[model samples]
Target: MCTFHGQPCTYLRGPLPRKRRKATDPPEYRSQPNGSGSGSVPGMTHLNLNYPHGLNMTIPLDHHDEVEYPSPELLEALSPSLAGSENLGPAHRQPSLLDGTLGLHLKTHSEYVGLTNYREPCLLDLHPPEDPHTRSVRRLDDFTIFMIHRDRETTSETQRIADLDAIEKVVHPLGASLVNLYFRIVHPSFPILHKKVFLEKYARSYHEFSPPLLAAVYLLALDWSIFDRTLSTSSWQPDQSRLEALALRTMNDDMKRPKISTLQAGLLIQQRAKNNTWTFTSQLIALSHGLGLHVDCSDWAIPEWEKGLRRRLAWALFMQDKWGALVHGKPCLIRPDEDWDVRPCRIEDFPENAADEEHDPEGSAEVVIGRELFLRHIELSLILSDVLRTFYTAKATRRNGTLEQIGTIGVAELAKPIVLMLRDWYAALPEALQLQGTRMKKLSANGSLHLSYTAIDLALHRALLRNVSAVAPPELRHAIRMGARTRLVSAMTIISNLQPEHTQSFWGFMASAQLASIGTFAGLLWATSDDDLEATFYCERVEEYLWSLRVRSQAVPFARDALRMLEAEVGGLGPVRASNLPMEMMRI
Candidate 1:
């Protein structure tokens, strides 16, 4: 078996045959005939122009297998001169004897040309004899040759070895503390890398992993370490800038041959970026495509572990593209039409260790803890992508006309189905993953899940507010206002309940911006309500939420900024109602 273009091929046994073509063969087998000439061969129904020499040949359409034949017009365009030539010869003829004049002239004139025993002077050294004791070199078979070349092309960084001494100096001292931080925080949200395989390789040798990925793991691990009381107090501090620099340098070096590690490193860098997170995420998507992460690997003859990793990474990137679009207010990169049929990830895909089995029943513990969270995240992301495609997309706006037009027709017509979908998603959540009655942790996967759920509701409610007005049937306008108000209250409640210490646990930058939008939207609702009692009630809840955010500013500074913005907007509010407010003010 051999691989071609990343797909497998098989060899079939055949015997070599000896045959010679005559110059007198039919015109169809020879060079193409000029215009109006009879070039058709007997028993042939179709003719194709063979490449390079404009040779016309009989290649019946029914007999053409696998390959797509070019059109006659295209063939003519490629070789107009040859096809139009009047004086044509048999295409299978060998080169003429008179082709090389210099060789013939030298042989005819030289005195020593016919003297076979005469030796010629030489400048280069004679070929060396092969060693008798050593194994003789044999010609490689076709499959072996292909395999060698493929390996050469795909292998990442064969020339340079990472500095083991330097890497060990950084990672070894942290011991299991770094690993704990990753599993507890990073892995729960972005489960791109396999923990068991990573730890197993790290234990064998720090050099076993790619330098960029190793450095990335340490960098992200250290970010979470600041939250760990014991680890934070240690006299020795990890150099985050140094690790990040090393990771970035190594990542650039390996750009020509991107591996799974390269994708993982890109994701880690994206998490840490303050300004260009979306730009970096887009670069990661391109790198992933280069690594064939966008192509479904289910049929590829790779290991089960690798297949699982590919599926996980592909989905992770898909989520990044979709969610990043929402966070940055940019168009999503991964369209449903362009994405491959990569399957949803499974629990068996993750590498297991003895520690994994200790949590619950032998067969299902991993599913209960990590896999469910990841699968649920994937499901929610898919819904979010659809939401963006439907309501938020430019195409949707052109079709639905302005927000007032959409509201005139009833925003609930578009929003009702999505609200049901969101409810169903929440309903289907596993008991362990549910937010209700669950004690929120500083970095709980369940808490992140709750935040995501609330974010979607906030996005939908904000969309409805785009055209909520008295002109749009009274009932529809009232429903839109009430829905927006209720969702705003719910979002504020979730944000207010989050403890100050847990602020860092939320996904960075994007989550902060999303929380800020929620607060701003709540302020808009409170400012626009006509009823004094209702306005006052929402005002107090908004103030309470702002107070909570103010106390948590040390952990979430963006939230603090959001609170200040909301206070300024609320302070300027008068009798001006939500229906009368500018559409821009109501926008999320």
Candidate 2:
């Protein structure tokens, strides 16, 4: 009966014969709106003769015990297909009489596969979510495409249920692809090669989307993956040649690109300064301990030089931290308290809401504070600290009879001059910056409070070295000078941390100001050459200071390293011409 073998079919249709009419309900009879025993609506009257004819003609007087209807066993003889039709598949074959009936072939497939049987729209019910992860991924993907294809289009949230269902299925599959997309393609540089590699290798076969479409999809996926670890520095083991090449490339880039404008550079410096305060202080302490050159305030006179250097380092760190906070849009913690003594004044008394500037000219001076100063200060501190460490170590040699005894008198003598320089420097500052009253009161309580430590250190060193006159034989003066030089080199290591913005400035200071100062002191020593004086005086200073600081445990080895370096430098000095040497040196 069914010619089209595999044609579509509906499962629930049939053409079975109609049931016979009963006495009370004849086949042609109908109940009207008013149920007046007539086949008609409320306003119409019509007779039901045809319907009653079937009921009246029903001569089913087969009351012969109902013919003892077929037993259950006899009814089982019928085909099983008709009996079990309800259990058939949606498109299962129907009885011959039901052929071609509408909906008989309708099929219900598993929802696991999304397409509907008719290829028409169908409702998909998903669970309510606490967080819209699926929704975000789907939206981001579409947004990316929208942004790329129609740059001017607005990202509205209006969407269809089918799109929502599709989003849930795609999120997990697209995670990594999206992350790589943002880092490589959407990144500011959009390096062509990185993009190509990202598309072909990283994101290829990702959801079978077009390459351009994939790029945007990936970016959206990546946004949710950000964490703090993304910004940290991991261990980097680089090949030597590769490292060298990169360095060279960087140098080339520097040469080709115009230098950062002053304003830009200043902003950057200020930013660095704000953050560097805490970082630098913590780092310096760690580095000092690691290098075996820590200072202990209890046992020995904290050399004025060390004191000044630390102050500089601390201040620089503070300024850097302040700058960082500014860049982060945070309230500055470095600002002074608001309560200050001023003549009684009222804004209302001024004309047109403008202040009377005649009384406040000094407050209007614009000052540009930048990281350059902090960087310089840090460099100087590091340089000086290294110098002091070496000096401390050399003086601490056991043969020198406990560096404390030998260096105490000298440290004390230099303290006065160092303090004097600090006082002068403080006095030179603008009166506005100079604190008065209780602030000065606080300074007396805390000796490390001011920026005058440099002076304190210079005076301390001068006196400490002078003590050598009483402690060491006159012949040892050259050795003491050598010890001082060794420490100077160690302290200069901060130069390594100087950023490009401050590099030239630092190097210039090194070659001119710093070197000049060291040279002047070196000339005062009896050692015949730079090498001799450094080996003896500078290294010795490091030893003595370390012993006094009680960090002598580590200082001894560092002192020895400096001594060795000094020896090598002096050893390489080819024979000096007799005429070119200091004239009186030959007589010695």
User: CA shift at 272, candidate 2, in angstroms?
Assistant: 17
Predicted structure with the largest lDDT when compared to the true one? 1
Work out the TM-score per prediction.
0.66, 0.20
The segments of candidate 1 whose C-alpha lies over 4 angstroms from its true place after superposition are: 1-172, 226-233, 273-276, 353-367, 398-407, 436-443, 499-509, 526-541, 555-588
Q: Quickly count the clashes in candidate 1.
A: 0
Per-residue lDDT tens digits for candidate 1, residues 295-360, read: 555544333456677788889788778878987888888886666557777776665433543432
lDDT of 2 by residue, 1-588 (tens): 232586444432222223322447532332111122221222221112222111111011111222123233433443232244332223332112112111111110001111223322111112222333211111111111000111012221232122322332343433443344333212211111112222322221232221222323332223223221231122321232332233223222222211111111121122212122444333333332221122221121222222222233233333333323322323333321231111211221111111211221211211111112233333333333333333333444334544455464444443444445444644554433322211210111011112212322342354345445345555455555445454344333322322222221111101122222222233333233335433355345433333322332142222233334333332223333334556454222
Query: For residue 388, what is the lDDT in candidate 2?
Result: 36
lDDT of 1: 0.56
Q: Residue 223 of model 1: what lDDT?
A: 65
